[model samples]
Each structure stands twice: as structure tokens, then as C-alpha cells.
Target: MTKTDQSSAIPLDTTARLPAVTYVLTFCIAVIGSNSLVLGPIAPEVARSLGTSVALVMSASAAFGLGTAASALLMARHVDRLGARRMLLGALLGLAAALALSALAPAVPALALTQLAAGVASGIALPAIYAGAAAVAPPGRESRTIGVVLTGWTLSMVAGVSLSALVADLVHWRAVYAVVALLAFGAFATLKTSRYRDAPAAGSAPWPLAALRIGGVKPLLVACAAFMSAFYGIYGYLGDHLHSALGEPVSANGIVALVYGIGFGAAALLDGVVDRLGARRVMPFAFLAVAAVYLGFALAGGSFAFVLVITFLWGLSNHFGLNVLIMRLAAIDPARRGTIMGLNSAVTYLAVFAGTTGFGPLYASQGFEMAALAALVLMLVAAAAGSWRLPASATPRN
Candidate 1:
């Protein structure tokens, strides 16, 4: 395993902190993150242009999630052997190509294929980015460093979707994607030249998925998957639901994206709270909160104000809860941190696929709230399951 003197790296919590590198990588993280919300803002436009139903149009989200999940399960381990910097550059290039192809897609099937490509790239990018963060972070502030960087996901929701919405209105939906593609390309170019370190590890290790079979690990994964299913399910269809309820002739996708993002961006500070409470103690309640907000969103109807509140709470709890779970899981076997991080990414995206896929027909037939009610049931189960086995490593550090 490679080792570096801590004194050589930037102090993570210093008054004059080293945010440039973190922020640059964070920006790259945000670029890939656009794929997660890209279809949401443009769902209505994509359906109309491609001549498909809303449910069918949104299937692209499922395809993307599935691709990401598959990559996480099938290919993420390569991040360790291949090196994070190389993997990141490769993934970003692939993502750019996928988005470019998505811009020119003539049919829903073509879109799905390209989205799958993008998802796979994203799946690959995540672990590399996280590993890169750990490599660069100072010793004492590992959790805090991760928490700050994760805000990129939330930031993507705010910036990527909101801007894409407005851009789609003025230019073309394809144009919005083209711009995102450019951002990805630029990030790739910058990252290629930077000095970010690779994740240090002993010579290649076996794939670590079997580690999940250990005592507290399996339950945490299940609880995490269940919790994620509920959160991602509501978010998948949030745009279409908003468009239908508002009765706006034009899709106010920008407005919808912006409002949801506002909640998330504002709530990005929840990382501090999670740090203090410890994930094991706080995650179950956060999952319950996710369930409640999603349930409220499903029944919100014309009450735009209620939707706003629900969106904010959804951002706060899910981000905080999920981060805690991953951190706790990584701590379970520090030696296998890289493998566990990859598996966690796989589970997260796969749960999103489950949520989007299973909930689509229900969302079509019964509306978003009813589907949310189903997700709520799953969240309760996750909460209960989580209560059964809190890992000793997960005690609050604060």
C-alpha cells in the first residue's frame, strides 16, 4: 500500500483551507451528477418530442439508474486497480459522449441506450471521486471532507436542473444537454492536468461484495437500499407531477427544479448535524422523515406551498441519512473501504432503479402520492430493520 506524510497535504479544517482542489473535483462530481436529474426537468419535453407517454419517457431515468447500478456491481472495483485519476478521466469522457448522443437521439430507445452509457460512466465516476477525496483529505477531517463534497450532489439538483429548464425553454432541450456536455468536457480537461492522488491500496484484492455477509453489514445495506428506494422514487417523477398539477402550458421545469433544489442547497448544512448525532442513531428517523415528505408530496395537489416544504425536508433527511450510513459502513472494515464504497454506490443507484421502475405504473394509475404511500411502507420497514442492528463502529464521534 502507498503511504504519504500527512504534513504534505493541505489541512482540511484550516482557516486558510484548500478548497480549490476539492471544489474542482466537486465541480466534476456536479457535472456527472447532472445525469441524475437531467431527465426529470425535461421529461415532458422528451415525451412530446419522442412521441411517448410520460411513463415511457421517464423510463430513461430507470435505464440510467440501472446502468449505474450495473457498473457499480460489475465494474466499480476497477477503480482501485486502474487508479482514480485515470478512471475519472475515462468516465468523464464516456459521460460526455453519452450526453452528446442523448442530445441527438431520435427515439426513446436510443435515448435509453445513451442514458445507460451515461449511467455506467456515472457509476464508475462516483467511487473514484470518493476515493480521490479520501486520498486528498487530511486525517482528522475525513468525515467532514466527505460531507462537504457530497453537497455537490445536492448542488447538481439546484444548478443542473434549474438551469437546464430555463435553457430548454429558450433554446432547445438538446441545447441544454449540449451545454452540460461541454461542462463535462471542460472538467475532464482540467482534472486530467491536476495532481489529485489515486486511492492507495495493497496489490489487487478480491471483489469485496462478500463482505456484505458479515454481521452488521448486511442489515445496513438492506436498510440503506430500502431507504433510498423511497427517496429516489418520489424524485424520479417529481417533475411530471409538478407539471400536471400546475396546469402550465409550458413546462415550468426550471421553476420546479429550482424550488426542489432550493430546499436541498439550503439543507446542505445537514452534514454537520449528521456528524454530531452519529449515523446509526439518526438514519432511521431521517428515513422516516423521507417517508413523510414523499407521502405529503404525493397528496399535495394544488398546494404548491406544501410541495416546497416537502421538497426541502426530502433533501435534508435523505442526504444526511445516506451519508451517515455509508460512513458507518466504511468504518466497519477500513481495510476494505474502497470495495465497500463501490458496493454502496451500486446499492444506491440500484435502489433508485427499483423506485423508478416499480413506482412508474403506480404513479401513472394512482398518481404520485399513492406511489409515495407504497414507498413510505418500504421506508418504515427500512427504519425498523435498521433498529435491529446498529454497528458498534457507528457510535457518534462527537
Candidate 2:
């Protein structure tokens, strides 16, 4: 274990509890998840509006995911140079611009470009926010604080997907983008005036260059990539499956989103429980459980209630891998925080791109069952690799 002098490292006065910081960071996570959910629910409608196939509309999400992943390496350099607050504000502003552009997009490519821009913003801002949380979090409560922060993602997914689906049903698909634009602008303005500290500068090469030199980081990065590939593969194209399998194109999106949100939120809340029970012991089983859920997803579309239960389990296990991995990384040398998190975001988003982009075509042509099976295979691979890669030190006690 590593220890740092809190007096020298942490930025704000160590007097009052960091109230708004947590709130603001959680809000940011919510914003990121909101973007994903918004696109998911309205995917088919957006496809029709753009005069394109659902596969093509889905590629916008792929573009966003790929852009976010690819941009993380570059954004780390900027975050190092400009500081977290500045970078965050800029990203938020950029996201608002992107959302506005997406809403008014005259063509699919233009919409994809906007989503790509949003992806860049999301890539940079999210890890920076997580870094902030680690810096300010009260002692002995890091896992719980992180879990609390992730709950925003759950809320956003639930609220964004369900509401956006309803809006798409009642109004138009474009309305979802318009609402996101306003929310991004609002979040940006709120965060602009807030006080937050940038991490102490480590004199190092850019994240990508530095990552090339570091060997220990590779295993963790690979594990994260594998984990996220499976995670996003299932969640990203779920709306499409809801339409194809259940034949509930309009309302199914909202219901599926609700199911996932409840599951994710409940699982996140259970992080404390996992902590008490031991993360290692709980996490392995969660992975296996989630793989089984994927199997269920393969078989689920026959019944609405069955889909709900399966989606819940999927959400629950998704966090187990992520939360545990983060806790492990936080225990690594603090100087490497930026690079570690940058790669984490990079690989995860790469998986997102792969899963969302790759599986959509597969799901469209081959059908939902095969796509679901593919997700299961990916998760099983992840579980096996993760079991091997997890640092013994990071393993939770049974």
C-alpha cells in the first residue's frame, strides 16, 4: 500500500466536508450516462429521421464511443496542461455545442461528427471527475463514495432512456437531443464557477507515450477493455433488440432502461455490502452471474418480465468489475493517476465502440440471439482474464 501526505497532495482546505464537489462530479457522471441513454432509446426513430438504416444510426453511437476512447490519450495531455476545472468547463461547453449540432444535423455524417465531439468531451471530463473524487473523498469511504458517484449513471440511464423514449413516442426523436443540449449548457454553467483543484503535475511524457514505457499498466488495461467490450455490447444495442425481439419498438426502450437502471442502482448501493463481504469473493461470482444473464438475454425476448429480470442482473454485475478495478488502481502510485485513468477510459470506450458498432450489424442481420451469445462469450473471456490479472493486493478479503 502507498501513502501520501494529505496536507501536500489534496488541494482544498481540509476543514469542511467536500459537499458540492461530490455532487458536481456525480452530476457529470450522470451527464455522460445520460448521453448514452438518450441515443439508445431514440435510435430507431433517429434512424428513420436521418433516412438511414438502424445499423447506420447505431454507428453514431459507435463514432461517439470510438471518439471518446481515442481522445482520452490526447485529453490527458490537455488535462495535465490546462488543469481539471478548465478542461471540464471546456468539455462541457463542447458537449453542449455538439448536442446542439446533433439536434440540427442535416445528415447522418454530421450527427456522427457531433456525437464524436461529445465523445471527446465525455472521455476527458469523466476520468478527471473521478480523479477529483479520489482526491477529496473522506478516508475509509473511497469505495462507497465511488459507488455513490456511479449511482448518477444509473439515475441518468433510467431517467434519460425512459423519459427520452416517452418523448420520442409522444413528440419527435429530435426532442431528446434538444433536451440534452439544454442540460449540458446548464451543467456547464454550474461547474464553471465552482472551485476545484487540478492534480499536482508530474513531469512526464504524454499519456500515450508514457503508457508505452509502462509495463504494469498493460494487464489492467487489457482486463478493462475486455470487461467494457462485453458491458457495452449488451447495453448499447439493447433498444434495437427490444424492437426486433419483443416487437415493442416505442415503449420497450423505456421499460428496458428502467429495468437496467434499477438493477445498476441496486447493485451500486450493494457495493458497501460487497465491501463487507469482500470484493474478490463477491466480484467473481458477479461476473459468472452476469454471464448467465447474458445467456438469459439470448433467451429473454419471449417474455417482457423475463427481459426485466435479466437486464437487472446484467446491470448489477457490470459495476462489480468496474468498481473493483478502480479501487485497485487508486491504490497504485498517485503520480500515475492520470495515465492509469486515461488508459482505463480509453480501453473501456474502445470496448464501447466495438460492442455498439460491431454488434449492431450482427444483431440486425444475424438476429438478437446470436448477438446475445456473442456478449456472453465476451463476458466469459473477461471473467477468465480478470481472474488472472487482478492483483492479489487488490483482491477483497473474504
Candidate 3:
């Protein structure tokens, strides 16, 4: 279809208000994020249940990451051709089914395969969710809308993690996936029935390669990589550091996570500042703030109280960095949003793998202090990339 024709297909809301469906998108994101993180907390239980080693069970998470990265790179272009709503519905259905299968898997390999399927669905669903959010947002409210959706990560970190651990202890590990499956189904139903209009696909070019050539795409992606990698690398080892170095209990780590989630969720209130300042102007400072937070981590790694405080700041700064990165990418090219976001998600999953694996040896030998320094360096790199200039046309409207 022609660009003009594609634009015409999307029904405009005369009132210019954010749609109710945005909340459903947030819920969907929470469920998807939960699936990605659940394995970490429940790995031991899953390993015991399947008669496998903890490392083997954990490998399922890696399989899921690989599936997500591969599918995002290869399948995200379909969002433009299929329309966001249709793509999202299909993805949600697939996710629900995959999670259900995960819950029922009789062996470790079956669980890994099912989780991989879930990851593929997630790879598609996330970009569609982002594109749909941007599509339905009223002018001047794009960043705020995206920020609201991003709080879903906080939900995953707080409620999803805590509840999964509880269920795994009190009930069974499989129940965690079962609950997530139900949540996914619930989100799918809400979205399917909501009054939200689907944004028509705008890009006609073959997307995977075409999106990279777009002005301002590459730098933002680099920033995304560094940003995500830094966060995951430090996060992957935080619990171990607390237990081994500081002699803190597991509950202390949970407290840190809760405080961080509070900061992340609270930062959504300031997203309007980005909407006013423009993502391009806000991004570098946001990334710099994250670098500063990492420096704090390096300095305060020994004190539990200081760690708690720094973790909160870490979440707060990271939220702003995430908000700006996504807002900028979504604003860069409306026609190619699906592909751009797909690439963004691809880089994110790959970074998750890279961060954990790359930081493992350094963290093991040099300890948490050095890992924090490593993350600080990466955040500095992200800050520099965020400073790169974008085409005038690619800047988000203030």
C-alpha cells in the first residue's frame, strides 16, 4: 500500500486524548517482562522438578534470549505489513500458549523449547506495543505515554519477581508460568475488545536493512546497546555480591529491588519534562545520570544502606535514559517504527546476553566494585552516543 493510503487507514481520534487501551498495553508488557525474568528466581525449583542441573535450567533463559533476538531481527518487519493490533493479538495468543506449554513441559528440553517460543512471541509483541502506544498518543503526550508503558518493567521487577518466588515456594515453580499465561490471556482479551484503533503500517521498503540507513538510527541503537548491557551486567551479579561480599541476606536484595522499582515507577511522573524538552536534548544528560549512578555503586559497594540508596537512584536515572531512547527512536521515522523498534529490541536482548556473559569473569575475579566500574564506562559510552546529532526531521515534536 502507498504511504498516503496507509496513513488514511488509521482512524484519528477527534478528542486527542490517550486511549484506554494504553493501560492494557502496559499490562501486556508487564506479563511479557515477567516471563523474561521469572526463570532467574525459579531456576532451582525448575531444575529439581525436571531432574536437571541449575545451570541447565538457566540455559533455557539463554535460549529464550537467543530466540527473541533472532525473531526480532527477522520477524519485526511484519508489523508494518500486518498492522500493530493484529500483530499484537497474534503475538499475545502465541505467548499465552507458549507459557502454558512451559508450565506443562515434562522435561528440561521441553521447557527450554517452550520458553524459546514465548521469546519469539515476545519479540514481536514488544515492538507492536511500542508502535501502538506511539500511534494512539495525542500530540505533546508521546513521551508521557511511552513512560507510562515503561513502568511495566517496574511491575515485573517488583510484583512479578516477588510473586513468582512466593508461588514457587508455596505452590510450585510451574504455577508461576501458569499465572503469567493467564495474565497474558487477560491482556489479550482487554486489547481485543478495547476501542483503540490500529495504526496502519507506513513503511514500504524492505525494513531490516532499510531502517539502518535512516538518518539518526545507528547512534541511538549504539546508545541502546551500551545502556542495556551496562544495566544487565551489573544487575546479573548484584544479588551474589550482596550475599558474598556484604554478608547480607536474600531479603536485603529483595529490599533493594523494591526500592529500585519504586524509583523507576515514580520517574514516570516526570516524563512530561521530556515531552517538553524533546528526547534529543534530554538523552545525553539522562545517560550521564546513569553513569553517575554506576559510579555511586562502585563507591558504595560495601555499605548496605548506601547500596539501597544508590539502587534507587540507579532505577530513577535508568528510567529516564530508557524513556528518552525509546521516545527518540519512535520519533525518528514513523513509517519505519516497527522495524526500528524491532532492531531496538534485538539489540536489547543481545545486550542482556552480552552483559551477563561478558561481566561474569570480571565480576568473579575483580568483584562487584570492578563490575560497577565497567558499567560506568559503558554508560559513559552511551552518554557519548546519545550526544550524536540527529536530522532535524527526526526530532520529536515538543
Residue 233 lDDT, candidate 2, scale 0-100 = 71
Which candidate's TM-score is highest?
A: 3
Candidate 3 lDDT tens digits, 1-398: 21221112245332355668878889989999999988887888888888889999988899899889888888888887778889899999999999999999999899899999999999999989988887777766777888889999999989987788899999999999999999999989998898876666553635686778887789989999999999999999999999999999877777888899999999998987876666777898999899988889899889998998898998898899998888778776677778888999999999999999999999999999999999999998999998886566654322
Residue 31 Cα positional deviation in candidate 1, in Å, after optimal superposition: 1.1
Summed backbone clashes in each candidate are 1, 0, 0
Model 1 / residue 202 / CA error / Å: 0.4
TM-scores, each model vs. reference: 0.82, 0.82, 0.94
TM-score of 2: 0.82
Q: How does candidate 2 score on lDDT? A: 0.71
**lDDT on C-alpha atoms for all candidate structures:** 0.71, 0.71, 0.86
Best prediction by lDDT: 3
Candidate 2 lDDT by residue in tens digits, 1-398: 34432112334322344456777878878887788668766888888887898878877887887788878776755655555677778888888889889889988899899999999988888767666666566654555667777788887987886788778889888888888888888888888777765655567535565754453455556667767777777676777666776777667767777777787788766666544543434545666777788899787756778888887777777767677666555444455555566678888877766776788788788887788888788767766655554344543211
After superposing candidate 1 on the true structure, give the runs of residues whose Cα lies further than 4 Å from its correct spot.
1-19, 43-59, 106-108, 237-256, 292-302, 360-370, 388-398
Which of the predicted structures, 2 or 3, would earn the higher lDDT when compared with the native?
3
Per-residue error at 329 for model 3, in Å?
Answer: 0.4
